[model samples]
Target chain A: MSLKPKTLVDFSFQALKANKLRSFLTMLGIIIGVASVILMIAIGQGAQAQVMSRVKALGSNVMMVLPGALGRFGAGSEGTAQSLTLEEASAVARLPYVANVAPVVRRAALVTHGANSWTTTITGTTPSITAISSTMSTVEGRFFSPADEKSAAPVAVLGQTVWQNLYPNGSDPVGTTITIKGVPFTVIGLLQSAGASMGGNNQDDFVYVPLKTAQIRLFGITFIGLMEVQAAGQKEVTPVINEVTALLHRLHGLPPGAPNDFTVRNLSQILSTAQDISGMLTLFLAGVAAISLIVGGIGIMNIMLVSVSERTREIGIRMAIGATQRDILNQFLTESIVLSLTGSFIGIVLGVGAAVAVSAFAHFPTPVSSLSIVAAVAFAIFVGVFFGYYPARRAANLNPADALSYE
Target chain B: MSAPLISCQELTKSYPLRGMEIKALNGVDLAIEDGEMTAIMGASGSGKSTLMNVIGCMDRPTGGRYLLDGVDVMSLTKDELAHLRNRKIGFVFQRYNLLPRMSALQNVLLPLVYAGVNAGRAANRALAALEMVGLAALAGNQPNQMSGGQQQRVSIARALINDPQVILADEPTGALDTVSSAEVMTILKELHQTRGVTLVIVTHEADIAAYCERMITMRDGRITGDSIIKGKRGA
Candidate 1:
């Protein structure tokens, strides 16, 4: 008997109505697949964003002096801790394109103001360091003046956390004093709370002191811990690092082409490398999630096969009632697609939910990309139609007489 | 000249059973005129059921010419046959094959829906058919809630919904009790008498065949008798 195309809709919708629970469960496969992809991409993207911001937080014109070469996840080393000394920092400041150089002497220290003591780090630097480095700024009160630096005055600048803890009642600490290891250092400034560093160090929990006072009264350092070379302009940063590297080699008495005593780190290179690595990592994660979607598509094919088997008699009846083979194919295919699309929609919602939850509780980066959602849904529908076609074709091609006899 | 509604010449239907062709119909030639209440009776495997399916457009003969309303229906495409089945034939199955999810009214309107009839007109037609079958009151009730006899009647009403040229019944009363079967046969006879619808019944029960104006008997896929039951026309 003849069959019209419209009858396909009727056949499948009726079949779905006949078994609502079974249809919904079939949809679950797509839902899980879609959710996995979205969640994976969101997490990978968030971690990528955090890394970028950390790299950006370092001043664009500043170059760090490190010792030896190391990969991105660098192997830990204690050799040549003073990669560039105070003399190298002074010479860089004297260079034609150099702006200001601050030799960084870092050490963990405990500070006390009225017995409210906090264990934090102290970064030793000259008073001009705030104007030369991206990581230094005065948020409240004043930074240490040149007069305080020349005299090697015992004055300190409090970080955001030290200020909050040592003065919880909001009293101004500019004229007051905080003691660092039984030595009295007047509070001279406060830092603008910088967030975590590229190396994952919390910048807000530390204090800054004059280079002379930190060396004389605290650690007694002549060679600075690390040298920061600030170029006069953004373009001069690379040349400044090169000039400083040359000066440092001469100071260390290292021969030409000898194993370097120090290393110069460019912020741009680090950022680009980080960006490339994170991009690859995101694709890797997304690929892992996509595996589940393939599994889901396979599930759709299996279910359709089982459904065709169970409805053989029904198909026979339809054929006898004047339905054509194409009509039968479309009916079963429509059912499979409906099931997959429903699952995809639910999974998208669940994925967004997981992203929000992770962002809130774990503070892990999770931002929903609209592109991923749309792709997942489209993929699910395609999987439905593509995989479902075979089983539907099998049903349609069956002989009506033979099918009617199927038990 | 008024054409016969169904005409078949040298009609044959065979099935491959265990590597041997089992002949269900063999070169049967016949003509069925309009507005006649007819019954075909036979023992099991006598081809009564097979002939019903072929004439009803549910199956095509392996080799024969079947002309319905002067159209070569046997050679038509599947979709065309479905259209003809919807337009020219209304079927009543022995098991009362009503979709379980639908109410009686919806069941009757099934064919009309595929016919693209508007919902309002389909409902009206469904109601009128149900009323004709004495089932108008149970329109909202599902098939499971109705008795076997009532379900069969609903199936009858459904067949009548599309206003087809013939009402085809295959052992329709075989599943019903005596009283219900009699009532169903009464409706079939009435439909033929009042609406001039051609009626065809496939049954083994002589009691049910007694209600038709003419009876044809078959044995081993061959017609053995054809006789008119006179005076039972309006009885």
Candidate 2:
């Protein structure tokens, strides 16, 4: 027996060369399935990475102390509520391991800059917030200072979006007054544009001001919403958290045996948990996409089996001309694999297109991973082998006499 | 003759239809020398096709010794038998089993493809075969685009491409018109006479069988008559 290729592309591109359209269509299923898998994972992973970096941007040592640890949706812990105050924020800052502390007080407020008025969110924070949260970058003007917080200054910092919207003209709005709920505050700084959250929320669409000023002027006084503490180093985070909890308990006048009313979260843990959530989300979506692959594989098998029956006489003729079972098997196997691989390649392109379109045009945080692309292509090929095999073997094993005699 | 190129002793083949064992061949013995053109003919269900399959090594005998050119076919492995078929035999089918997707040239080059002949040599040989059958100009056309006679000619070219020792034609002209059938028979006679290749054809028509020098007539599961006619039997 004669064997092996003497041609770059098999000169024996017999069936494929003949039924190009049929072959391409047959392969299309695998392509779509594979592309779906790759595109979904790539975009998913890309988004995951973006969210992860944003979470990490909170700083290596940043810790969040949330009041009233609530499980699931509603039902915040009553009586056990540990309300964080401006003093508590200072106490956390005073921890030996602490570097800077910022009190976060968030509220939805209507803002006005001349005739173009929009109801945007106002994030009440200390000046150190700009330095602590890695996710947000102040764009044009300087952020608030410590003196501004101590003096309870009525000055404000605008994110890129808010600055751009209120100042539609190409003019710097620093030192300009923008009223929040009829209260005038000077725009001392403009923040850098933060991209977007996975939920598609604009990270750079809020207004920032001194926490004390926000409380006294707008929301209320004394009790703060959350204490945003930044550790000097990652190693100091646990100690800082312990010290802050101790300080909160002492301030709350709670005796021993009561459940702690506050919860502290590190940046690393937050980043990992966010990644895990997105990873699980990717897997779930990919699993759904795999159903399409299975469907595609089944379609190939069905088509191939039909092809075998239709080409029974041809198989018989080949066998008569000295082609062995293995040779017949090889030919059919090659056809199926080519079909699946073709589909996989095309599908991957479509998937990537979909992902890129969603991210760039639709503004989503999508993660494109190399591993997902490779896996998708491999899986498409696998679908070909897995599904296309039985029909080929059946064709190879067909009785020559019976096949030849078949009309 | 040194050793008969084809030899068979007590060859038997049975078909299991439903619950019954239908004997397609029962204790058949035959021998064929090299450079012979033989035709086997019978009515439907007369076992002529079964004998053809057995002689072609497409099927194994239930009980018998089949020595093909001194190699015991029964002792040979499945792959070896297939190798023998590819290296030693060529085929022309009644239906002209050209792959519908391929051109006439590709159809002619099929046997050569399995033989692993490079396209250069394979194409040249395929062209030569097509030329021999006067189908050189129709090489690029698909089987469907051509006349039945042309497709059958392409099939003939396919059979001759590998330069096999034996060319087995099973009613090669069965699907062709009277003119095409005559043309196909004429080509078969020339190959046997000029190339000195052993040729075997299975047919139901006496006229088709008469194209060969020798005719073996079968009935049921036995050979009823075997004889050699002068020149070309049909002519």
Candidate 3:
């Protein structure tokens, strides 16, 4: 006869209570394993979101063509292999559907005014940078003009942070002279502070100079690092990218099917690629952490087997009183499931608590996804049912007469 | 006339010892009338316990046609046998075997729980059984908290809670003192005569067997003697 659910549950609870310490030890493994898995996934998701947000902060509908044949390794590694010249940047600017293009040349240089000296990034670009990049805007004075860029004038725009550091008294530094690598340049404008991006990079820690002055006066280099192109509209980005790729391919004289000498990537594509990699990495780590749960399940099976043997006489008594094999099986199986579910409840609370703790104390962004919580709970139930089956079967298969005789 | 409540024809039970087999019950036949209190007495290993186990439906005979209440028990499935044991048979073990962690009330309610009785009626019936055994005051006590006699009474209460047609007691007084043993024997006799329930007791003590209506003796897996108690105890 089928035993009542309430009876089986109560019996299981009482049995577990009889061996309190052993039951707790059996549940500990599952708690630790599930908690670790959840924490790792939460951290991974947090990092991915941080990266995506930083990428979005760069600009919209803007694409970069780095001067190399982008390979399987990464875009950063490709930059050392190739460098774009001003000629190539100008050639791309003439393409249709392109709203504006800025050829960027960057270098780390020591800048000094009075007795104060600081190491800061110096970027050489044109006035079109203000139009092409969403992050660039002036709060004081105005940006250098196209004529100033063409005339190779030694002019500059001080970043908000560099300006503040140099003029801590809050004096206006616009139109003041700052030495770049021992060369004097006039600061024609002041940029609004953009603070730090999600990557922890200080955005307002640089100075902008004319492309010609930076190339000829600061550091003698004919090639630029990369070029940024902004499309006229959101719909124009694909056509602009196609035109640039075709233009660069012809300029480098590459045949069809041959790899291009340069790589063009849009902002959204980079964001999604970053997301995919991080997502894959999270799953991989979560999968590894899930192994501990399996180990915990094995521990449960071991304990349950020992418990069955220890309670052989009890089983015999219950059987003598008309407990069917299925009844015994149900009771033991219910005990195991109850064990894991208890562990699961505690693990979920701990996992989320750890996630929130990390976010609060460690200054990381951790978003606790409800889907993961549900999945973890479901997995705990699955573990219980899976591991509880074997020992329960062993108990059910025992002979009542022999069990009665067991010491 | 109604058939006997229990009838076994040529019942045989054997177990393998090493390579050869040891017969525990050797083609023994027995019949038990309804409302009759019978005692099966024998030395250890003489098959009295095995006989009781078979009659209690805790084991099946290897070769026999055993009938209980005119139904073939040998033809029943394992679950059917369990149901029959729950509904038609109650067992009181020598050790009392009350789950030590449970109170007397919970222990007594066990059979009803297995019988799928609802909470309210099961609890009420368990209390009534405890009251019948005169242990209603000790119903809240665990087995360890009670004396041997009290524990035995609680087990008897458990056996009676299901209101089964047959009560099987295997050395019920074996673990008790003289006073406790006499009290248990009195309860069993009262249950038999007052309730008209069939009672089967397995014991080696002749004094305990004297309270029954009939006595059957076994020797080396075979029945050697059977006699009706014409002058029953206390009569």
- Best-performing candidate as measured by lDDT: 3
Compute each candidate's TM-score over C-alphas: 0.73, 0.76, 0.86
- Candidate 3, residues A1-407: lDDT per residue as tens digits? 57888878888889989989999999987898788788888998898887777777776589988877767776543237455778988888888878889988888999987778789999999888998766789899888899999999998899988887877788888878889999998888999988886546898999999898898999898878788898888789899989998888887778987888788989878778878988998898789879988998999999999999999998888887778889989988998998998888899899999999999999999888888888888888899989999999888877777777688
Q: Count the backbone clashes (under 3 Å) in each candidate.
A: 7, 22, 0
| Model 3 spans with C-alpha error above 4 angstroms | A68-97, A106-123, A130-145, A154-209, A217-225, A233-235, A247-260, B18-20, B231-235
Error of 1 at B155 (Å): 1.2
lDDT of 1 at A11: 59
Residue B126 of model 1, lDDT score = 95
Chain B alone: TM-score in each candidate? 0.96, 0.95, 0.97
lDDT by residue (B149-194, candidate 1, tens digit) is: 9999998998888788988899999899999999889998898889
**Candidate 3 — which pairs collide?**
none
- Candidate 1 residue spans exceeding 4 A from truth: A1-14, A60-265, A316-327, A398-407, B1-3, B230-235
**Mind giving the per-residue lDDT tens digits that candidate 1 earns over A157-186?**
998888999999978789798899778999
Which stretches in model 2 have alpha-carbon errors above 4 Å? A1-14, A17-21, A53-60, A66-92, A102-226, A233-263, A365-367, B145-150, B176-180, B207-212, B228-235
DockQ-based CAPRI category assigned to the predicted complex of candidate 1: incorrect
| Global lDDT scores for all candidate models | 0.82, 0.80, 0.87
Poorest lDDT segment (10 consecutive residues) of candidate 1 chain A: A71-80
C-alpha displacement of A390 in model 2, angstroms? 1.0
DockQ (Cα-based) per candidate?
Answer: 0.18, 0.47, 0.54
